[model samples]
Target: MDLQLTGRRAVVTGGSRGIGYAVGRALAAEGAAVALVARNARHVEEQAARLSSETGARVIGVAADTGDDASVAALAEAAVRGLGGVDILVNNAARTNPGSIPDDDLEAEINVKVRGYLRCVRAFAPAMVERGWGRVINIGGLAARQSGSVTGSIRNVAVAAMTKNLADELGPSGVNVTVVHPGATRTETMLDVAGRRAAASGTSREEAERRMAASVSIGRLVEPEEVASVVAFLASPLSVAINGDAVIAGGGTKGPIYY
Candidate 1:
């Protein structure tokens, strides 16, 4: 499992922490030079430093707001200069604010993940196409496959549609584009959610965690690194076979078979 990723360059949005950080670590471990992009400069830099030290890989942090056009343009330039041209772009930066059925205003939130992802892909994918080699793994959510939040479903399904279209357009150019749907990943945000659940249910945080984990078919919530492992593979040349597909990395949902 060499992944054949040595010397390959990668750009990961939302790399300051959580799932993005985990993906950075995994990619670095597989010997890919990475640019960690996030809005918080200091936080992203610190995480980059740690990942670089641990994996002995070239990892750099670039601060930028993906939802902003100017910021994303600057980000693409910085990534090119840092990693020496992006061979892999992981669109993992997203806003996870929940919306209601009546939905007051989710456009801004949805735009950040949907439009933000599109911005990053637009900025970087062309270069990959020119080089005739690239991997674009867009992070979606399980809501896309189910019916719950209207906004969530819309955005995630939008990502899937975008992936298929990109794959169709880029396949001839050696660029593989795909989307991943992760449900209730084990991250700091999940910890915050568990804490809230604990307070609301008047139970211990540990109990809340168990309750949340038990809801999954795997009998536990999937770790960030677990999801990252999938991204890392999808980010490599080894993943040429999975283009335009939606890989679920949420430790499997309880019931409802998705094929």
Candidate 2:
């Protein structure tokens, strides 16, 4: 399907790897000019160059920490300058420090997830409003619903609320804001978590992964492209009416609600 996204300018945070990288590739496949943002300069630039070569899209990379206001502002400026303007913003950067308990340093999680998201949105949304068209896809997580033992559950819940609030605020300005909950995707983080669970259960990582997969209705982990495809669709003209909605890309989460 032609998503009618050719020539659209997009910025994706944490675009160096995992789901963010997949999302960037998906957008580029639709012929959109993409700017990749990540804290690691070399990795981000390398990925951007590779994507540009592979997809033949105008792909640029900016090294900036989303947790810092100055860095986020600079990233926004760089994206607009590089892409001519920003038509889509994918707030995909997130941190899940399971070791950090609530009583410990909650600030670290807040700084990276909550503050970082807000900073990027604040820096980029005005331009979208001015142009009168934009798509903001926030990568939320299933933790928002299950709030399991994961340390990032609180932050995910906050992100879900922020997604709804931003969708409401930006909807009137011709910007569609939506959140996606990609549950148990095959990413580095997921593998690490699986290993941890395996150690805790005195079982192999593969076995632990299998157990986790069995918990889902589809009986398997989600693929990064599955989530990315949804993101691309949401950014495309096809989903103009899907604002303020949280689409769960999980393999039918273990819940009564459709999610």
> Quick one: best TM-score, which candidate?
1
Give a tens-digit lDDT track for model 1, residues 1-259.
8888899999999998889999999999999999999998999999899999999999999999988999999999999998889999999887645223335446875678888999999999999999999999999988798886777788889989999999999989999999999988778988888888899999998898889777688888899999999999999888898889899998887778666
lDDT of each: 0.89, 0.88
Q: After superposition, how far is residue 146 of candidate 2 from its true place, in Å?
A: 1.3
Error of 1 at 108 (Å): 0.9
TM-score of each: 0.96, 0.93
Q: Which parts of model 2 are misplaced by more than 4 Å?
A: 96-103, 199-202
- The residue pairs found clashing in candidate 2 are none
Per-residue lDDT, model 1, residue 136, is 96
Pairs with backbone N, CA or C atoms under 3 Å apart (clashes), candidate 1: none
Per-residue lDDT of candidate 2, residues 10-73 (tens digit)? 9999899999999999999999999999999999999999999999999999999998988988
